[model samples]
Target: MSLSETQPDAAGARRIARPVPLRESVYSAILDMIVSRNLQPGQHLVESELALMLGVSRQPVREALQWLKNDGWVDLRPGLGAYVHTPTVEEADQLLAVRRLLETESARLAAQHATEEGVEHLRELCRQGFAALEAEDVATMVALNAELHATVMRLSRNDVLVELASQVDRRVRWYYTPVARHRGAQSWTEHSALIDAIAAGDGDRAGEVMHAHTEHTRLSYLEQQNLEKSGADAGSPARPITGRRP
Candidate 1:
């Protein structure tokens, strides 16, 4: 349970402040690790280890695991304990398809309402993204990519769209991480075109560019998954589809 303190202010309005629940914080930490693949999919989750890793107690870890299970982030077995949920190909495809729809609409709206500042912000991000790419900084590149898309969503001025995008943000990042490097130059190039369309206030062209941009990513992810499956079937060692940072 979460506790908060309420006090009267000068105008008699109440101000309440409370720290986040420990279980909730633990849940977020574990969820992030899972999303980053630090806790690989299907990896067994040891409550004690998690407690130790997070500097918390077993009770909180246990609570967090249950919450994670409720959220489809983990699976609790009858006797085998908890494990990270391994998403199926269908799960990935469905999620990406939804993203494409939401983001395409966001792009169109952003073009309609984009300010000079917003477009410039996107250009700055693209510049940083290109720098990250050239330096082989995979983590920065992934983060900037996410930021750029999120910026576009915000520029749309559609609260519901932004909230919807936030809901799948983690999973989208999880899937994108494996293809970030593979998408590389071409991905940023698409972003430049998207920026141009939005900057020009060309809603139709912006939607078209964003549609192709997101679709390209979707296809790239699917292709990588297929390649990995083939390689696995051929008795070859698994390879990282997105090459590691140099």
Candidate 2:
């Protein structure tokens, strides 16, 4: 029998259903691997192995690796394939500094320009974030956390500011994914304060709160690092932060 004639229509239908778009699928797969710590910083990405694991062609994997390189999540090395990028303490500090400046300005603008509808949306986002936290849905909480920040940036209505904030948001997420569980209720409490400030339309207060929040994140990261180092010195397992799957 011919191949077509041997196969039932339903069987063929299942096999011929379109696959996910190559670029997007590969991007998401690699991102998830990175977030989950399956691809640790400085770990090499072997194209053939990744292609086999992802069940796709090397072309798509290569394209995704290039995109990740541009995002500062991977480093492309000549003859050595791509390696995951690690943020140094210095780099983290610099990023947090920039984030504080940009986000605080964004919050100030959001307070001034956010319409009633925008404020309501922000409130809903905060509510959902807290609910997710209460339920111990770390993934949902992380997603909502990004949504809340993005919504505020949109309300700001400054294209340049929004773009900067978007970049910072990605880095911030990478930082948070590892530490979200440890942060626990404190994170949501800060979000509540931020929401209250924004809802009150107090631009100066909103900016101040945002600035403090960013600084608080920086401090927490620093403390975590210190704790890890101390633990190592004391001969305990160096509980390094572990990221979530994307």
Candidate 3:
């Protein structure tokens, strides 16, 4: 029943799928830690410690660290080892703007193509998100928010758009994790409107709703940065792209 045990061979016979290598698994683990802020910005990454913590060998850890460096997630100093990359305001803004563009298009497409079942599914997700909000479960709210967006992307039914969105997805999660709690009720309210537009099959309305919804998040992040700047007068620097574990 495992993915690695269920793949079909070239001749169409069943064969074990090649299991993912340890190095790739380690890479994914480290990436999750970074995205969740368990490995914070500028925090030193000790390979031996990470290997031990992850119950893996140093070889895979080393390989994963190198991969992280290539992906701009971890910085490897010439002699000082590795550290998590400190996300900048400019970087966050740029990435978020890209997400907004992609999601707006997705909303438009979803409205054009949405089925009744798909719209109902979106509404169910919206309800779950609201319930999470009511429970003040930021983690669940954040996850449900992601699922809602992903469902919209799927409903869009554009492989090219989905591919482009996939590229930006993790980065978007990294940025949004910090602001999720702050987004609160208004975020779900907007999701409701977006669902309504899709249900109505109003592509223009769907796009408009998504555009505004994404802009709210962007503005909120900017405002958060501004607040941090205000507080930095006492010498505490603004730390952008914070995360919390679910």
Looking at model 3, report the run of 10 residues with the lowest lDDT sum: 237-246
Per-candidate TM equals 0.91, 0.79, 0.89
Q: lDDT values of the candidates?
A: 0.91, 0.81, 0.88
Error of 1 at 175 (Å): 0.8
**Ranking 2 against 3 by TM-score, winner:** 3
Task: Tell me the tens digit of each residue's lDDT in model 3 across 1-246.
Answer: 755556545435555689999999999999988877677778999999999999998999999999999999999999999999978889989989989999999999999999999999999999999998888777677778888999999999999998999898888777777788889889999999999999999999999999999999988988886787678876886564554434
RMSD of 1: 3.9
Error of 1 at 238 (Å): 3.4
Please give the TM-score that candidate 2 achieves against the real structure: 0.79
Model 2, span 83-183: residue lDDT tens: 98977778888887898888889899888888889888888888887787778777777778788888888988999998888767767877766667777
- The lDDT of model 2 is 0.81
* Highest lDDT scorer: 1
Distance from true position, residue 221, model 1, in Å? 1.2
Candidate 3 pairs with clashing backbones: 4-17
lDDT, candidate 3, at 62: 97
lDDT of 1 by residue, 124-145 (tens): 9999999999998887888899
lDDT value for model 3: 0.88
